[model samples]
Target: MGAGPVYGQEVVLTAEVDLAEIVRSKYDFDVAGHYSRPGIFQLTVDESPRSVVARKA
Candidate 1:
């Protein structure tokens, strides 16, 4: 599960379980635990939102 164009400096993807790792490894993003969600991970790339969105899965 994922959504957003959070309008920040990084491309942030909210993915759960195996999906999180897949996104991170596939895209070379860094994976971190979501602040408020269990079993969910945040994959982040330090880049413009528009640029990252273009690389969507």
Candidate 2:
């Protein structure tokens, strides 16, 4: 086996939610994997209270 190099990338996302609903609710996100030419790492999502962060690492 051989080692590989790594590339860096940054992404940002946002969404709105209804704060008048139940204290807590389960919400689903329709996210899928990516298929493309090899380069570095893979795509990922970083979720937060006010926004979401995505990146291709």
Candidate number of the best TM-score: 2
Error of 2 at 31 (Å): 32
Q: Give the winner by lDDT.
A: 1
Q: Give the Å error, residue 52, model 1.
A: 21
List candidate 2 stretches off by more than 4 Å: 1-8, 23-57
For every model shown, what is its TM-score relative to the native structure? 0.18, 0.20
lDDT of each: 0.58, 0.46
Query: Compared with the true structure, what per-residue lDDT tens digits does model 1 show for residues 1-39?
Result: 557767847875775577677766855543343444545
Q: Give the clashing residue pairs of candidate 1, or none.
A: none
lDDT of 2 by residue, 1-57 (tens): 223343474434444666754344323322332234335446777675663677779
Candidate 2 has a TM-score of: 0.20
